[model samples]
Every structure is written in C-alpha cells, then in structure tokens.
Target: MIFMTVICTNGFSRPNTDPTASQQRTSILVLNLMPNKQGTEDQIISLFEETNLPIALTFMYPKSHVWRHGDQADLAENYVSLDDISDQYFDGLLVTGAPLEKLDFDDVDFWSEFNAIRDWSQTHTTTQLFTCWSAQAALYTDFRLPKINLEDKIFGVFENQLLGTSLPQWFQIPQSRFSAVDRTDVLNCPAVSILGDNQATGPFILKANNQNTLYVLGHPEYNADTLSTEYYRDLEKHQPVKAPENISLTAPQFAYAHWRCCSRYLYQEWVKQSFLLKENNSHEQKQLQF
Candidate 1:
C-alpha cells in the first residue's frame, strides 16, 4: 500500500485525540492524470491540510499511459501503479483532470485502465470526486451522457451558484477545458443532484445520490496563478486563449485566489459526509448481527 503522511498546521488541532492512540484515518486514493503530477499533488495536499482530518493519501498513476512529465524512476518510487491498488478499497477516491478533453473517452491512451478504475470505484470507494475531464468521463461512462465541445475553450475564472443544498451559496472557480457536459443530459440523471452550476459553464458540481460521488467541472483547487500559467503557456504556443476574468494579465502576481475557501469547504464536506456514511453503515451492520 502507498502510505502518505501529511501534517496539518493551519491552526486546526485535534486536542482530544491521544497522540499515541491508533486513531482512525480516512484513506483516500488520488488517481493523478495531470501531466504535472507534482503540482497537482502539492495543490491537493495543501487544500486537505485545512480539514484537519487524518488522511492516508495514496497517489495512483495509470500503468497503461506512457508518463512524459517527470522521471519515470522517481514516479515509480513515489507513486503506486493503478493496477496494484485496484483490489484495495478506500474511504474516498479522487480522479484528476487530464488534458485529453478534445479526444473521445475511448480514444485516450489509458481509457481501458481508467474504465477499470471507474468500475472499481463503484464498489470500493464510499465517496468519489471526479474533476474536469474525469467528471466528463464519469458522466459519459456511468450515466451515458455526451460531452459537448465548446465553441471556444472555457479557460477562465467563472462564477458558480449553489442549487439550494448543504453546499456553500456561491463561489468562483477556474475552468480550463475544451469540452463540457450537456446540462440537459445531467438533468436527466435521476440519481444526481445538481449541487452547483454556472450560466456559461453549464453545470459546475453534480452529486450522485447525495452520498456516493461528486463531479466538479471547474478546478477549485487551482492556485492563484494556475490560470495565468495556462494563459502564458497558450500564448507562447499561440493557441488562442484569453486572460482569466477578475485577474489582470498585465500583473498576475498581485491577484488573490478567492476560490481556495470554497474549495476547502467542498473537500471538508465530502470527507465529513464519507465518514458519517461509513459509521452509519457499520452501525446498520451491527444491528443486523443482533
């Protein structure tokens, strides 16, 4: 098993729990699909630290895809192969977005492996969170929805309004994708609850059965300059992109990230709900025994 230890030092402390005692830790597996695996890892670790939940985060990479970003040797040493962890169950699963939004789901290099992982998640994980392309893939694979290609890339900080749920009212999140899930297709899914959405971006967050899974279309965990970095990279490549809204392209250094607050809230809520569901299920099993 890939073990991850992260220290939470953001003023939140668990004073009641004894340091020597074997506290129950939430096990979360992250399927890292981003080319910049290190960057994505850092972002998630930083965000989860605020929740103060004891988390054993195992990083999983697709063995089928030819990794191109970091040294293969280093990745092998640090991360677990997706196939190796397929049999193991976890309290939570997080699937990151890849840059393969334009390609059909079946056309991606690691599509078969991803599909297998998706199948494993249905029974293995208590709660699953799918981001960006992964979210689109979930909608397509699990719900038989089609991903709609946008006229232009949705690359900016857009507003998302919560749909009268336990989630926060409204927030802005960074979006960088070539395609989006059809709003109509999502509405047809009987098990999904639209937690949040945006006018331009269609749907932002979809919760399956209010407990099993969540799909986030935008990158809420994005750092302040993630959008700026993408914009500059696109500019260098001459890939027709625009500056992120509410951020000054002339001076991105001074821009503040307001999304981190909501992002933390989203994850914290998921972790909290997952634990509650586990506890409730355990209690139900105990009752059945009697």
Candidate 2:
C-alpha cells in the first residue's frame, strides 16, 4: 500500500506518517510568484497531497520582488529567500504563475532575478514544472518565442484535447490570461512537444523532449471559485474585463470542478517521471563507480 505524506515547515496541515511505507520522500521547491500567497499555497499543497506520493514542499519567494499584498513578516518567516536556497538541491521545482502578464518580460522588476532562478534550476533541480505566465516566460527564455496579446482575456473553463495518452482524452482546464505563445512557434521548435491543445486556447500543455521540464499553459490547479473570484475582483477594481465564458455569473456554485481528476493525473505523472529519472541517474552513477 502506497501512502502519501506532505511535510511543510510552515503552518500548513501535515498528514499522519505511515510506518509501513518506505520510500524516499521527493523534495519539491516552489517559487510562488502569485499575489494571493496564502491561496496559492493552499492550492499547490492540496494538489501535492492528492498525488499520494511522499513529498516534502519548500516554499520560496524572490528577494528582488517588492511585496504589495499580504503580510511581509509572514513571508519572511514562512518562505525561504532566493539567497537561502542558492546552494540547495531539489528533486523537483514548481514555479507558479504571476499576474505580470501584461508587462514586457524585461520590464518586470524581478526579471533579472527570475532569469537567475531559471538558469539555476537547469543544474540544481532534476525536474521543473512551470504554469501559466511562468510557462510563457520559460518559452520566451528558452526558445525566443514571443507572447501575442489577445484583444480579450481567455477567461473561462476550456475543454482541451489531450495529444498524448498520459492524461485523459479530453479534460476541462481553466484559463485566465491576456497573452499566449504562438502555436506555430511551439510546433516549429523541435525540442518541445505539445501534450494538450484547445481549439481557442492553442496549446494547453507542453513538455521538453528530454522530459525534465513540463509547461502547463492553463490553471488546472484552480479551485471551483477561483474564476468567479477573479471575475468579481476585476469588476470591483473597474478593470476592463468581461464575464468569464462557460461559467454562470448569476450562480457561481454551478462552476463545478470538472478538471480535478485530470489535474491529479497530470501531477502524479510528473512525480512518477521525476522518480524514474532519479532512479536512472542513480543507476548510471553506480555503473560508473565500477
């Protein structure tokens, strides 16, 4: 019987340990760039727990970024600074999406720091997972792919067709973005493969040919109310935002999470692949010692 465990030093919930299970816990370092720090933490931690794998999570924030929302004291106490983990290693790295999609890559305050972390991850981490804007950032940095701004935001629950058999044939994924990478550019790049695609949203999931990196272009980790929250938040702020498609504004409860299963499947697959890569590397090291 496989047992899952999540160890977070912060004040988050910790599950009971199983004595029978004996597996090396995978360490995942998350560089969360989201404005709602606590909400993003909850969403990511819940996803890791559902994977049923022994995992240890370490949350990180950029020192170069200025905090506008949330308590600064809590951040300093709970999350590690970039300088804190510069010499550390992890089995996996997860970089969350930020709200900096509207600005040019070079215009962001932490662009240099972000690039430093991205470059560091290449050698320090075994596997990397990037979501939403971070996915766009990775594509731009690695492939020089430009982001095309849409006249309207792709805000809604979208049904995406899976190009690979790793996940279900079709699944719903939530998208809330004003920019996207060109599909032709992604297809033209030989080093990347599109795992999932949507008719309106273009490529939803992409993987590097070497299998060390995964890019998720949508918010599969989003809660049922996430879209609704964003919609109302924008309206309250008087931003030029339209109502999210395929979701009812009158009855927000109708936004059932149809993509939860797919989200779990995708995360579990990533963990499994990371473990496989670790094992193969270990085997190679032992062979070389002979």
Candidate 3:
C-alpha cells in the first residue's frame, strides 16, 4: 500500500486516483484560523507526512469570519464552512491558532460560530487537536479557565518538560503568544491533564476528554524561520513587540528548528491514538446493537 498525503479543499474531489485505496485513508478536518492559509496548510501537511500516514485532509474556515489577510474569493473557493460538513464525521479535527489573543473570546467576530464548531466537534470528531489561541480558547470554553495577558509575549523556542509518559522527558517547542492559561486553574481542574510544560511558558501541552482532545499552547509545527518572520513582521507593522528571546544573537534572522523531532513525535502519537479511539468507538457501537 502506498502512503501519501491527499489534500482536498471544500467541494473538491479527492486526488487519489485509486478509488479503493482512498477508502482506507484517515480523514482529518483542519479548521485553518491562521492568517497565512497556505503556509499553515504546508506546516500541518508536513507533520502528517512525516508520520507516513495515509490521510485525506479537508480544510475549512468559519463563514462568519471576514477575510483580512488573504483573498476572499480564494478562501470561498478553497475552504468549506462548518455547515458544509455538518453530516460528516471525521477521525480527527485540527484547530489552528489565530492572532486574536489580546481580545476577549466574546469580542472576536466569529466567537459564536467558533463555539458552534467547537460544540459540533464534540460529537462529530473522534479526536480534536487545538493549537495556541485555540488551545486557550478550549480551556476557557470547557473549564471556565481564564487567560492572563503576559507582561511580554512568550516569543522564541523553549525546552518543555513532559509531564506524561507519551513524550520524551524534555523537548523544545516554539511559543509566540501574548497570553496564557492560568496554571493554578488548570491544576485545579479535574477534566484536564497537563501533559507538558515550561517554567516560562506555563502549560505547553494538555489533554482532556479521555485523551480525545489535545491542547498545545505553542507552535510545534513551526518552521525554522517562523519566529524570525513574525519578529520582523511585527517591527514593520510598528507593533510593540520585542525581539524573540532564546534565539542566536549574532544571527537573529534565522532561527534553527530544535522542535521538529518533538513535533513529529507529538503528531504521530496523536494520529495513532485517534485511530485507536475510532476503532474502539466503532466496536462499542456494534456491541450496543447486540
């Protein structure tokens, strides 16, 4: 059997020429909230590719959200709305981070719609993975946890200690966020487990809902220069952003990706766990019929 990444946009046909082979591929729906749509697609697809998993991808965006960075026509053509896939069930759901950290969750324009999609995932998807802001958002929506604005953005790569047995003892992850969930609240919560954390970045990874949902507060899928690009972009926009910390001083323009190994391991584990959960659920349903 050949293993390849098959990416299909909304209303688009699967590119896998072999119809029978497509039936065996895992389906993952990505809610791309990042401003750079294509870039985020490449990063996510790369992670799955490294796992060597035969998967079919469907990219979707909130219809309530207005296009700001990319072309509206392109997004309308390439992305699906939550309503479009209301009847479908996915093996996995990936929610990308947005740049709206400073605003309250209720203040975001698509806040209601975001909650709708999040609610839908509870029943429609087997496993859900939330990154960065979406991670914080999930904590808020489910646990009543509040996000605290950092005095300074937690920008740059930092080594995180794994709190669970799923990953290595230590792994570096790239963080670029203006806020974080309260560690005390997470510690007090009963539904969630802190999987990985850093002293500076608080809880970097969390799992809840019987490990069916995963939250990553940093960008593990980030490329080597993602942080550098953000740093320079902020400067150009005259945003009050500091130079990313923990990067080489002499060559700040290029940041090395010390997090790729951990990133791949994380995604691989998630996919494996997702498949197991799906199978177990399917078996449970069959038993219920008897």
Candidate 4:
C-alpha cells in the first residue's frame, strides 16, 4: 500500500493517505487578527501538521488596519492582501481572535472591511471557523447576539463537553479572552446550534448549516506556552493578570501541550467533512450533466 505525506512546519508524522484517493488539495484562507501574525500562523498550522489530507493555506490581513505585528517586508512577501482574495472561494476559512474584545464591534479599526470579509465568507467559503473575538463579531453581525465582558479574563486550559454531535467527543481547549457570550444567547440564535459548553466558560462551539459555519470561543490552536507568554507580557506591562489554570506559571517553563491531540483531531475532521461535501457537489453536478 502506497502512502502520502502531509506537509507541516511542525515536525510530526503525517497520517497515512490512500494512493487511490483523489489528490485534489483543500484551499484554506486565514484572516489573521492577532497582534502577532506569525505566531497565529504557527499555532493554526500546527493543528494540521499530522493530517492525511492535502491543504494549501493563504494568510490575509485587513488592509484598512495599519498595525505592524511582524516585519513589513516579510508580511508583504509572504501574505496576501484581504482585498485580493475577496472574490475568491475556499474550502475552509479561519478567522483568528483579536485582542480588541473590550472595544465595540464598530469601534474596531477595520470593522467595515472585516464586516465585508465576513459577509463574503458566507457565500464564498464552504466552511467558516470564527475564533474568539471573530466569533463574537460574527454573532453580533449576523444574529445580534451581544458579548458580555468578563470582569476577569478567562485564561487557561478548560475542559469542555460536546453538546450537539459526538464526533469530536470531549476535549479541553486553551482560552485567553476577556469577553464571553452567554450560553442562553447562543441558544436563542436561530442560525446557530450549541456544539460544546463549559460550566464556567459557557458555550465554546456554535454550529450552523450542518457545521459549515462554526464559532469557536476558545483557542484550540494555542500551544502550551502561548498563554504563559501572554501572561508574562501582561506582567511586564504592570497589568494585573492571573496565572493560567492547569499549567505552571512560577517556573516560566514549557508546559505540556495538552490540547494538541484534540486540536489536530478536530481540524482533520473538518477537512474530511469539507472534502466530502465537495465530492457530493461534484457528483450532483455530473448527474445534472447526464
């Protein structure tokens, strides 16, 4: 039996791929909203490192916002402008979380442009995954769901249970957000179905259109020390911040990547479903041709 390798920056073994299967690659577009674009890219990329499917990722940044997260020269050469891909379609779309959760949706620097991009994703992309602030933004933009600001940040690894479907089963995710949406609000949204929930952090996943649209409230892509780094950064600024739960903060060392297994599993499942939908659509098109 012949096997194919999945390419990823992280040095992990790829799942076996059937040689007879179609080699069509899945195209994924990421809208990076974090302050550190490269870090966000690496976190998201690590999730698919061990997948069996072929994927091509395109990174996009808001043209209206002028913040420097990394070297401008490198960003220009490596990433595509959001405007360039507005009219294009992708198999998967990922919208990363931002640090501006305290600000009103309209107050965001690139709110209008981000709104346009969000609108475009509804029809142009097969599956959309909105994380953290993007998830809150989508809820507000599409369903009028309001986000409640937590007095303290929800920073740490928290356990969550699946609510809707059982494919993902159960998992824990790393969260570092200052705002949260009420489980009741998600329950009230006509277009969304709650997929996962936590007693303390409320709902995590909101699904719509048979999981074609997903609102993930936590950062499943975060590496173990991602939170630790953020915590120390906040400390340096003299901001009052608490240590991440389930991980050591005093040692300031590398923490175990407990979320890695579930993160990879969820991403691979999404890729599998996206390909299945594409295949079904092709079959229907061919049937129409006959």
Candidate 5:
C-alpha cells in the first residue's frame, strides 16, 4: 500500500522523499508536451501513487514547437528551460504525449533537444517510459518508422495486456490517443518489443531491447473524468469524436461515468525489473526486504 509521490511544478522536480537516504534516488524526467502544463504533470504523478520507491519528476517543454491547439506556456509551474537542463541527469524518464502530427516531428522547434534527452537516456537513465504521443515521438526518432495518422480519434478506456513475468506478457498500458502507431514486424526491430496491442486500437504497450525503456500507447494516468472532459470539449468545438468502441453496453453515454484506475502493480514491477538488471546484488537485498 506504500506509494511513491512525485513532485511536479513549473519546471524542475525530484521525488518527494521524507528524509536522509543512502541509496541513489530514482529520478524521472517528464517531457511535457501539453498545453495544460500543471494538469499534465498531475496526470503523470497519479501513476506513482502506489509505488513505494522514491521518484522525482522534471518537466521539459518543447519551447520551439508550434501549437496544434491550446498553449501551455502560461500554465507551467516548474518548467526547466532547455538551456537550464543541458547538464541534467536522471535514473528514469517519462515522455508525455501531445496532440501533434507525426510527420511534423522533424519540424518542431525543440525536436533536437528532445532527441538529445532520448539519446542520453539510452546510456544514462536506468529506465524510460513513453506515453501515447510521446511513444510516437520516441519511435519516430529512433527508427525513422513514423507513427500512423488516424481518420478518427481513438478515445476511451482501452484494454491492454498485463504481460506477465514469463515468456509472453510484458506489462500493462493505458492508451488514449487520436492517432495510432502503425503495427510493424517485430523481427525488424528486436530492440523494440511490442508488449501489448489492442484489436480495436493500435499498439498499446512497447519497450526497447534493453528493457529499460517502456512505452504505453494509452493514458493509464487519466482520471475517471478525463474522457468526459474530452467529450464535452470536442462537442463544444464541434469536432466529431465518435463514442469509444468498447464501452457501450448500457446507455450510449455510459463510458463517461465509468472511470479507470492506473495499474500500479505494473509500474512497480517494471521498476523492480530494471533495478534487478542494473544493480544485481543490491537488487536482491531490496527484494528480500520486500
């Protein structure tokens, strides 16, 4: 029942630990590409509520990017300007998704800077997780295989595989995005493993070869009311977002009332796996304590 609380403000964040510590803290840097800066940070933090380990979150805004919709520049609280983060380091990285066109990644203003962090995470951070659009961003940057554009937005509480610890299953995922990533042959990129996929949606979860990096194509961090908020917003804007596919067993608007909770077990499990591979002997001792 122990939870790891993450502190997020305008720019910089470190885990909100109680006191003195001997072990090296696990830090998570979130590349927030949302217009609602503080809200984005809050959604990501919701995921760490059940984690017992220490976690810190830092925000990296794409200062150079053009807005596809709203602007988050005014709402940011703990934002770290690109120049200020040039020498930063962390143990974990969580890339937040944004509503951006996939083909335009190369044209974003801060695209280069985000690429630097992604490249650094490979060797520096113990683990990395890409969410929704961020997963698209990472895949686009890594393999040159672009994220696919969709005819309609895929919005709902998606069912993702909680790939168990054995041969097949890898983890759990929450995917809430308009566009979906195109499925590719796993053999092409052994480094990129497709952990989960939705028959209705696209890739729901993925990870790199080293297993340090994880990606969720949906929004597991979304609160019960998130989908409702989107529904109202789209309706007002007159953007025709159809009712999400799976949830209409009852009334047509029923999915709005049905809320989803984040999968804490999967996150904590991933952390344990990464810690095991990174710090062998120490990891065993930690497990013993657990």
Candidate 6:
C-alpha cells in the first residue's frame, strides 16, 4: 500500500482542522521526467506555489538504467518512492518532459512504467498535466499520436499560447523552452482542445478529455532564469541551440503590443477559473468532525 502524507514545509502550515467542512485538496504528483532530480523538483514546486491551492506533492522516478539521463542517485537524497495509487487519489497530475529527444519513447526502458502510470491516471486522477516529452507520452498513450520533430529547437518566450472561452482561470503558460520531440494530428480527437499553440511552438498548451487532463507542451513551471540557464549550458556543451526571442530581461521597454495583451487576457481568464477548483479541492484527510 502507498503511504499517504502531505508535503508540509516552507510555508505549507496545517493546523487543527474542521473535519466535516474541510475540502479535499488535490494531490499533485510531479512525475519528474528530468533526470536531474533536485533541479526538476525546484522547477516543479513553483507551479504548485503559484496556484496558492492547498496541495500535497509526491515525486516518482523510473527505476532501472533504461535510457536514463543526468543522475538519479543524486536525486535520491530528497526523492521518495511509492507503489500504489491508494496512497491518496489525486485530483491532478503533472508530468515533465525529459532531455531524451533523440529516442522513441516506447524504445526507452521507462516506457512501460510511464505507460502504467498513464493508464492508472486516466481513471484515478481527476486531471493531469503533461509537459514537453510527457505531453508526447500521454498523447501517444491516450490517442496514439506521435510527436513531430523539428530541425531547430524552439527556445525562449515566443508567445503563441492563447486562452479560449472554455479555459480554466488557473491556467497560465509561463515563458520557457518548448523543445518538442514531435507533433501529432489532434484533429481526430474531439476530446482534445488547444489552449495555446504556435506553428513554431507547436501545441504550446492544450486541454484533453473534458479537461480531466491538462497538457502543456511548454515548461511554464520553469524559473525566470531556467531558459537562460539551459541556453547557456547548451551553448557551453556546443549543442545546437537558439536564444528565446521576445522575453523581457528587465522591465518592458518595448512589447509585442497586441500579442502581449492577448496572452495576458488568457492568463487572467485562467486564474479566474482556477479559483473555484482551488476552493473545492482543499479537503481534510479524516472524516468531518463537526
């Protein structure tokens, strides 16, 4: 059985609770696909912090040496493992993209583990969010769509994501690198909807399966310098890379004007919609007392 617990540290302070009236908060499992455990945790935790929603976070890693990158041993210092979904049924899931861009996901050793998690999530999780590679993984698992490859890596804040009428309030695409392995023909699935897209960014943000699974093709959970760090690191390694175009290093002097406003509106709308979920998802672990 999976042991259940809340990630309480930093500012996540929980006091005495009103058992009956308490809301059941969402459990977000950061299936950190990035091999660098510590770094990935830093990037992912920020998203939960932003939501201001009472949440419990757990991290999962693929075991065995099958196509793993970075170093999992280093990540083990802070990471934890669990065996089952009974730990606590989650309301949402966040899956990260990995650095492995050159291999087919199915060929990778962790493919089966990811497949199992994806399958379990469909019925167990209320909503799921996949980032970059995980987005591709989920797309393939649920709909058998493959990611399209690009000759050039799409880096930086190239604004193409937009919020539509149906978008939730808490949804926001923070500017980051959207290095996609490929694209899939989404037209065949009526349950899938695009929240953000750029021919350059591909499907930057999207919602699938009646909003149960929210798929973000980019890394909005990234820190301000996350893109810059990756860019500089790649350049140092002499790997092919590009600068993120049109993001503010300082306060804005010049802006895209129209595109900026549109993106802002999309973010605002998401925040509005997200509030309700935040309210409803905050739950107490034990049964109501009063």
Candidate 4: where is the Cα deviation over 4 Å? 1-23, 71-74, 162-169, 209-211, 250-257, 282-290
Best by TM-score: 3
Residue by residue across 39-133, what tens digits does model 1's lDDT show? 88778887787777777577888888888876777776567776667677777898999999889888899889888888888778877889999
In TM-score terms, candidate 4 sits at: 0.84
- Tell me the alpha-carbon RMSD of every candidate: 6.3, 4.6, 4.2, 6.0, 5.2, 8.0
Q: Rate the local accuracy (lDDT) of all candidates.
A: 0.74, 0.78, 0.79, 0.72, 0.60, 0.55
Report the lDDT tens digits of candidate 4 across residue range 1-290: 11333332111122223443323677677788888876777677666656656876667778788766566666555666666776777777888999988998878989999888878886777777788899989878878889898889988877666644653545767888899998887776677777677887888767763336778888878876788889989999999999888677664233445567767776887777666666776422321110
Give stretches of model 5 more than 4 Å off.
1-24, 66-77, 161-174, 185-187, 248-262, 277-290
Q: Give RMSD (Å) of candidate 3 vs. truth.
A: 4.2
Shift in Å, residue 60, candidate 2: 0.5
Question: Model 2: runs farther than 4 Å from truth?
Answer: 1-4, 11-23, 162-165, 249-255, 282-290
Stretches off by above 4 angstroms in model 3 are 1-3, 9-21, 162-165, 209-211, 249-257, 282-290
Q: What's the lDDT for candidate 6?
A: 0.55
**lDDT at position 68, candidate 4:** 68
Model 5 Cα lDDT, one tens digit per residue, 1-290: 54434454334234334444413545666677766655766666666755776555566666656545554454233466556666765556677777665457776677787887788776666667777877777877776656677777777665554354231343333345766667764337766766676667766676665446666777656655566677778889998877555554245334433333235655666656655645663322332111
> How big is the positional error of residue 185 in model 5, measured in Å on the Cα after superposition?
4.3
Predicted model with the maximum lDDT: 3
The C-alpha TM-scores of every prediction are 0.85, 0.88, 0.88, 0.84, 0.76, 0.71
Ranking by TM-score: 3, 2, 1, 4, 5, 6
Judged by lDDT against the true structure, how good is candidate 2?
A: 0.78
